[model samples]
Target chain A: MTTFRQFMSSSSLSTVKDAGTSAIDSLKKAKSDPSKPPRYSAAGLLVKGAKSEEWPRVWREHDLKKSYDVVIIGGGVHGLATAYYLATNHGITNVAVLDKAYLGSGGSGRNTAIVRSNYLTPEGVAFYDRSLSLYNTMSSDLNLNVMFSERGHMTLAHTDSALRTMRWRAEVNKLQNINSSVIDPQEVKKLAPSLDVSPNTRYPIQGALYHPPGGTIRHDAVVWGYARGADHRGVEMHQQTEVLDIMVEGGEGPDGKGRGGKVTGVKTNRGDISAPIVVNCTAGWATLISDMAGVKLPINTHPLQAAVTEPVKVFLPTVVVSGSLHVYVSQTDRGELVFGASVDPFATYSMKGSLEFTEELAGHVLELMPNIGRMRLLRQWAGLCDMTPDYSPVMGFTPVEGFLCDVGWGTYGFKAGPVSGEQMAECIATQAVPKLIAPFELARFERGDLVGEKGAAAVGH
Target chain B: MFGTRSFSFSFERSALMMLVPCPHCGPRNNSDLRYVGESHARPDPNAVTPEEWRAYLYWEDNPAGSLRETWYCRAGCRQYFTVTRNTATNEFENHPLPGNKTGAVDPSFHYVSSSVSPSVPTTSNAAQETETNS
Candidate 1:
């Protein structure tokens, strides 16, 4: 059913949008309309995509040729996603996906799993919007359930300046045909009915930029589904096969293009594998791989943290983010509350979770949801984010011929995985950058073309 | 230009000595931030002695006048703000150095806050100017 707040925001009634009618009407329309054919979730696809249950976790050259048409580095979600898109979309089946560890064992598994498109910059908003739309049907498209949830996401504004930014954002989102709007205090109250909105406050939450279309999903499902689907399409998956360095010799290495400085193949632990193209999909370690190829990027690495609580009665039905509070929390299907926060000031490669972060988040979240003060936090974890100053990912062709760049995923990488892979593959196969992928070039930094997205990307859910 | 800082050259400072704040950060003693009272005065580049130039870089008169000057909040705020302190009674007004438009009042915006005219003293200048005018 259309949420009451959504009906109120729908303006067909008389004037501009009203919160109550828009919320209710949207909910009602959704209820009346039937959903399309269901997509295969990752779990569902696991049974159908794999051969029973016994693919060796780590496969080496002893079993296969240890070589292929294309070699993708890093087995993390981005790398696998790139591999999946190449195989399924581009018909490049001679591709091999390699990871230092297990699939989805990196940042992808460590995220809060929240997804949204309520971004500030047009470049950012448009890019993320496309990803969200793709994720909406990722399950059906892959014939597996990634358990894609379409609940809702909200970003609360705590100051007049922040509220003004929300209004500005609402206008920008409308320009992009997105469903985000600047909600008032009353509307925010209805959406998160149990929140404490005290007026006598520091950083008082005056309103929010409500994105009813945004929500959280399962992170692990993305890795499994992509891997299984890619494998089914004749792509090889290799785990624990750390690529030490890439070997590019005589005339532009593999894919055979650039100043005869081609990449011949990668020097991996198992053995030497020759590939026509080597796509780097490593997130935190993208710069390392780039250096191996003599390609430099504007990418720097920073780690982001997230935590979850044990199952509680379903107190939260939507994702909540207080940008001012710098805290976000949501109740998972298992009744556990998943929480995530922004990256710390400095950059580091360490994955060790910090006690200070959890304590800060708990204090902020407790201020909003006072009743949930007694709940105990179960586990906390950290993930490395390949953050760019502009908060946008870099994709498509680089200075190197056979070496394509898809680094700089950062925390938003999980939500953009499928779309990122699809576009990067298109860029490679077409020999021309896709319109959607062209704006995120690694060279945009030097040319003074920064898409500042800090205002819209906090807690990421 | 978030990391950008600006420097301003005053046409009035050479003729009438000026008072400016210490750019360095210091303690609660306030005086821990010393002022180089009447240095930076310039004769034409060719006319002055190297010692005269040295004195410009090192000396002071902290003279009194309708003199342009710099003022520092040596006691309270640690910011390096400049002000015009009348040397007569050590009575002076403070203003940020110019060209840093975003942080300083724009002579161009003389229209909006007419209450703060170009002729008026800054917050630091207001009391002393009021006392002098009285």
Candidate 2:
């Protein structure tokens, strides 16, 4: 089977032709039933001259509305999923999701798509576990094949301290009813025989925190499914719509810091959108967007670079992570070895990958598995990570009235996309911070009550 | 002869290296240095509220453009120094004289282990300009 990248590269002409034909057919069908959500199933293969080539557009184009009940910035997984949950769960369908560029073009497209809930903190574990559960039923929920391969996830511990921390994490995960435990190196080898667990190497594998339910999934499909579901529920998905500024009505707020100023609407590149509620779901540019609403967040944007090698035989059966080496590697369904590293030391908005990153990444991967040193890197890319000092997300209502935030998701945002969306929707609907995400509020910083997941974060998640 | 000459240059892609102007070692590749993040003056803990303290500890300018930052010369002088660099362009402003710099180096800048030997500043303004433009 060809990889998604390969198919896109090799069959551009045929794909475009198929898309054009299918678009025309769908447009004709839409005229008969305007409310019909585009169904993309296996039945397309039955048609003459068709070999499962044509699929309906995942989302429809939408014009900018003068006003919306809620306006969500950033058409990533979080934004689309928030819109989806708000419509389905809360009956809030008059929502508009605005994106500066194409959907899922930010961290949603750039993440390695590893899903797991083996976090250290209780708040972290509960929150991410909820996300993992949502991902478990996501394929059926959205009627889209998300391809969530639950092969398992193993985090290798190289030192005594790392091993101790793994045990701690295992206990924490177990308390949350998550099937996670610390396993011996022998058991680790049994799960993934390709791993170099020998003691001869530098920082040899002491043991591993094995979580059997954690695995990888198709990230773009998740985004598309949520977007489709949201659009089907009458939520507007506007692409290439950049939000320039957030209009705020200055007033004495409950806090009396002028934070009571209400968010009137937002001025976008397309046009002005009058929204009662404006949600900042932009990851990397979260601080910039929040600053426009007169809300300051403790977020530093840094680039996290990742690279994927040419597809080889699927020898690696599980996701392998080494926080000591500052690298994580997992093989995709199409056999490409996806590798991720820690965020860049300095803060920058530039998504340009550096040669230093490639060099260091190769060296670190070689340290973990010397056999794959010959694997040629296909391509390298970088995505901005909004690194919080405490390494946790900033969610819930900000000081600016009606302006909510779901940002500061440095590395693990992709894993927690669903839960963040559901909880963010709840927060917006009820105007009350959900218990699961209460500890992650923007006010936590002021109260000096931080949920520091820096131990499990910073490098691998 | 057909139109005005537009000087064009082919850009070479490599490691995105920043030039750190070290007092003892002069300018060096960024790989040989360690970034200490944006330097901020510590507030008086006794007087400030928890909010102010948290802001001082966690809040960062994180500007996309030029700013003064602290960097340690790990491979060279083994000294901490402050340099003005454009984060977006990765361009280092040349400090003409020692006195014109950000005074003494920040002692808080921590060094990372590196084997590279200290070298004199070899980067030129024209090279940086070319890099930024490209």
Each prediction's whole-model lDDT (CA)? 0.65, 0.79
Kindly list the per-residue Cα lDDT of model 1 for residues A228-273, writing each as its tens digit: 6776567788877778778766545443333446777888778888
The positional error of residue A35 in candidate 2, measured at the CA in angstroms, is 3.0
DockQ for all candidate structures vs. native? 0.01, 0.20
lDDT of 2 by residue, A44-158 (tens): 3333235554544667888888999999999999999999999999999999999988899889999999999999999999999999999999999998999999989989988
The TM-scores, chain A only, for the candidates as listed are 0.84, 0.91
> What are the per-residue Cα lDDT tens digits for candidate 2 across B1-134?
11011111111112344556666675576767666666566678689887777777776666655556666666776665655655555545544223434434334332222222121111223312111100
Off by over 4 Å in 2: A1-31, A48-55, A251-258, A458-461, B1-16, B93-134
Give the 10-residue window scoring lowest on summed lDDT in candidate 2 chain A: A40-49
Q: Could you give me the TM-score of model 2 versus the true structure?
A: 0.84
Instruction: Give the total clashing residue pairs for model 2.
Output: 1
Q: State the local distance difference test value for candidate 1.
A: 0.65
